[model samples]
Target: MIKRLINLPEKSSFFLFGARQTGKSTLVRENLKNGWYVDLLHSEEYHLYLKAPEQFRRNSVYKIEKEGVTEIVIDEIQRVPALLNEIHSLIADYPGTRFIMTGSSARKLCRGGVNLLGGRAVERRLHPLTYLEQKENFNLETALRFGTLVGCAGKSEIETQETLAAYADTYLREEIQSEGIARNLAGFSRFLDIAAARNGEIVNQTGIGRECGLSCNSVKSYYSILEDTLIGIRIDPYIKSVGKRVSAHPKYYLFDTGIANALQKQLTAGLDPVRRGRLFEQFIVLETYRMISYRRSEAELFYWRTRSGSEVDLLIVKHGTIQAAIEIKSGTSVAQPDCRGLRDFGQNNPDVPLFLVGAIGQPFFLGNVQVLPWERYLENLEQWL
Candidate 1:
């Protein structure tokens, strides 16, 4: 098992949120195995708590007081949002009990609850395995093709592809249905395809709605559902004005490339150079996101695109200032012409460091911009920030 960077607090309660199959359960089981465990995903347990969350409190508090169990681990806590009320009370009643709750989605938990855990639990997020955790065993091709979902990692290429395929089929499709996020499963399924095709591009709700036969509002709601479920991210445009025209629309990216490919109904064998390059860009953008989240840095991730067509693939903003601008290229070698966007952005905001990531094996300097390989760039991402 890979070691996750999200460390559970020794004394305080915390929430571990992540997309399904990102190793939340595995991490909790491995690290908090000694705790009093509850699996909300189990049908029996889910109904038991849904019927009476107080039973959980009665049982767990009894065990904590009598059995000397100081830690309580609840998996899939979102399954019964009502339990959060009881949990909040328990935290107050039993100060010694360290409550660790894991949930794949926050939509339910965020609804109509005063003092969600009564300000007692700190919220922490988990993402697909970061390059630092996968380190020496990391495979760029596999990650780009199949993504970093821990369950699919280290499997045979065929098995990895199959696992991702099944994940899309069973988890994404059925889970959304079960969650009642979208009433029309068929329409949501179609929207999934359109959204996947538009991944890594600026969102156009009207355009997507037209394609999916959904209203603009419906498309917008669907996107919100994705965000709420932690299956995709919507990055707002960097809006500092920076003496240049910038686009206003936000860009969207699904959490995993393999799942995106599956939603698009495309096999890895069908990936052309253009498609592969786009996927590579998505992979790097996602890796950067995961790294930043794991580090818990005070930075916001955004993409810069101007009305005149100049673009910086990513901008890292810290303390209301753009600290770094990054451009991603799928090619192995970098040429001066390819550095046009970074150069232009640098000309305007020379204080911000510029980086160009490509498939090149070794690092080189292109004018004022630093050109580095994808792996090296991800490995040293924190330093750049």
Candidate 2:
């Protein structure tokens, strides 16, 4: 089994949230082997808890008092948010017990106004497999093409495509439609296609709404649904004044490239140069996101762009200071012209380090900008900041 980068607290009760199939259950089961495991997805357990939330408390108490159980694992905690109150009380009653709650979506818990344990539980997220976790078996081309989801690992090309396609369908049926997150499934489906097509570009909600026959506010809500479900993340534009007109819109990236491709019905086709480039940039941004999340860094990610078309792909900001300005490229070779965005960004943020990351084999310097291979950059991402 591939080891995930997230380090769960040993003593503290915590909530693990991730999109489905990201391996939250597997990770928790592997680490907390002696815990009392409750699978909420099991219809019997779900209906029982849905009928009597106190039964969860009763059973938990019995296990703790008579069975000598010190750890309890509740899978898909969001399926029955009422259990949280019971869990909260249990935590207060039994200080020795550790509650490991896992959820595929936080929409119900957040919107339903359920008890969140009063800060008694720390929260951690699990993302799709990262290169660091895959190590020797990692393939850049495969990752960029099929994505790094755990389900895609070690599978045949056709099988991987099938997995991604099924994932998209499952997400729509279970997370969106069944959960009633989107009232109009057809409109939301249309919006998803447009969103996947415009993956890395600045979000134009109005334009997307027009195309999908949805209001701008509806589009925003749909985007929130995606975020709450851990299906994607939004990268806001860097807003620090740099004597240039900057775009205010944010860009949304699907959690996995394969999911994006599957949503767009491009999984079986060969990715053209333009599509490949976008996927490459998305891959690097995702890696940066995973690394920052796994390391629990205080840094936040943003993209720098001006109305004049000069743009830097990513910026690492920490404590109100720009740590690094990075431009992602899909090319194997870099030239002076490719550093234009970095140069433009450096003129205003001179103190911040500049980097141009791409498919190059070695690291080199193009003026003040450090050109690095994508892998090398991710391996030593902390040093750059």
Candidate 3:
């Protein structure tokens, strides 16, 4: 089993949220041993909880008092939000018990204004596998092509492609349609393709709405659905004025590259140099995002873009300070021109460390900006913060 980086609280209740197939269930099963498991995906358990949320409290109390159960895991807790009320009371009543709540979508819980245990539980997120977790088995090409989802690991090329396609469908059917997050499936599906195609580009809701035949408001709602369901993330443009006219729009990225390809209907196609470059940038951005999350750091990610088209791929920020300014390149070797954005960024924020990460085989430098292989940057990612 691959070891995930997320460490659950030893004795406190917490919510584990992640996109499907990211291995939340497996991680919980492996690390959280001897716990009372409740699978809400099971039809019977779902119906029982749906009919009588109070019964969950009664049963949990019995297990805690009679069967000496200290840990109770409720998988896919969003399926029955009512149970949260019961869990809330149980938590107050039994301080010794730990409730592990896992869910793939936070849309229902947040939108319904459901009881969130009154801040009784902390929140943790699980992301698609990172290169650090894969280690020796990590393949840059495969990750850029098939992504780092847990189910894609160790699978053949064809199997991985199939898994990604199915994953896309599963999100559409189970998460979007079933949850009623999108009232018009056809329009939302079109938006998804357009969104996937523009994965790392600055988001223009109006432009996307025109392309997908959706209203601008509808497009924004669709993006919100993706974020709430853990299907994608938005990296806002860095607002700090570094002597340039900064763009205000944010960029949206799917949780996994393979899923992005699948949504764009390019899963089986060969990745050309241009396509590979975009995916490579996406891969690096995602890796950095995942590492920051796993470390539970205060760092926030943003992209820097000027009106003249100069752009820095990522900026790591913490507590109103710029931690690192990163420029991603897909080429094997970096040239001075490739570090243009970093140089421009450094004109004002020279104190902030600058990095140019790409497919290079060795670490080198172009003046003050450090150029590193993607792997090396990820391995020592924590130091930058």
Per TM-score, the best of the predicted structures is: 2
- RMSD (Cα, Å) of model 3: 2.1
lDDT of 1 by residue, 1-385 (tens): 6778766667789998999989898888887745788999899999999899889989987888789998898999888888888888888888978899999988778753534776789888888887788888977777777788888877887888788888888877888888877788888888888889899998988989999999989899898889988999878888867443233578889999888887776746666779878998899888888877777888888988777999989998888888789999998778999999998888889888899999998998988999988888887788755
In terms of lDDT, the best-performing candidate is: 2
lDDT of each: 0.84, 0.89, 0.89
lDDT of 1: 0.84
Cα lDDT tens digits for candidate 3, 258-353: 998888878888889899999999999898888888888989899887778888999999987888999998998789999999999899887999
In TM-score terms, candidate 1 sits at 0.95
Badly placed stretches (over 4 Å) of model 2 are 241-247
Worst 10-residue lDDT window for candidate 2 reads 240-249
